[model samples]
Target: MPFTLVLPDGIQYVGLAFVSTIWLQIGQAVLVMSARKTAGIAYPRLYAEKAEEEASFLARKFNCTQRAHQNTLEQLPAIYTATVLSALKYPVFAASALGLWVIGRILYTSGYMTGEPQKRNTRGGFIGSLCTFALTCTGTYSIISLALAAA
Candidate 1:
């Protein structure tokens, strides 16, 4: 359409990255902290019985319970790094990438609990994973595209 859409592209991209980062932070907080809090509240007896490492022990003990949270924690690095690079290269796609990663992560958590990692991600999880992967690749190619365009 036009060269600029009211705002400069770089500015827009940076702003979007900030918002994406916030969302990522919220997710991290939930996986790292809120989930633990929920575990503590849900299993008062476990906490009482094993005060030391109650949460850790409880999470480890329950099948499908700890795995979900652990999965989210595991995905944080790949997701965040992809988002950063995507945002820098392509803002709109970066947001989409972040959205996909979040959705994939949630599905991954559900899948972890179901004992069938592939099954749980059937609907949204698979799509989200695909989107995240696409976004990551897009971000990588975007850099090359920009360089080639400049050259």
Candidate 2:
């Protein structure tokens, strides 16, 4: 029988960028638990060997492994913004965007691993980034508005 999948190995972080942070955390764990896969993707050693492959081409040929890592690293800023903003303006919207973005990142990462990074498979991730940017702005505006009203 197929067991139901658990969020973050069994617990959910609720709907928010928390999920992406959780995943990025898992990526951290993979650094040791599955170090081979993590490092292989994070830093491709044979750029010339796999210059023709989809996943490695970006890392080896173009020398954009830093960019790949950057994409993973970018997950947090949005999540942090979402968490703080949600706590302020509309918690629900912030929460929802976080969840969506996390799910998007998963799709984005998985797609990048096997498919073309330039394809629609990773679109959700960029959209998630946009969501994060929007949520943060909204929250910041709300905080400023509240301050003005109080003043």
RMSD of each: 7.1, 10.5
Candidate 2: tens digits of C-alpha lDDT, residues 19-129: 556775576345323423433544444232353344544333232332334566765765675566554656666666667766676556555543355642454557766
- Candidate of highest lDDT: 1
The whole-model lDDT of each prediction reads 0.57, 0.54
Clashing pairs in 1: none
In model 2, how large is the Cα lDDT of residue 146? Answer: 69
Summed over model 1, clashes come to 0
Q: Residue 106 deviation, candidate 2, in Å? A: 0.7
Question: For residues 47-77, could you state the per-residue lDDT of candidate 1 as single tens digits?
Answer: 2224434445434333343545555557667
TM-score of each: 0.55, 0.58
Provide the global lDDT of candidate 2 against the true structure: 0.54
What's model 1's lDDT at 97?
Answer: 62
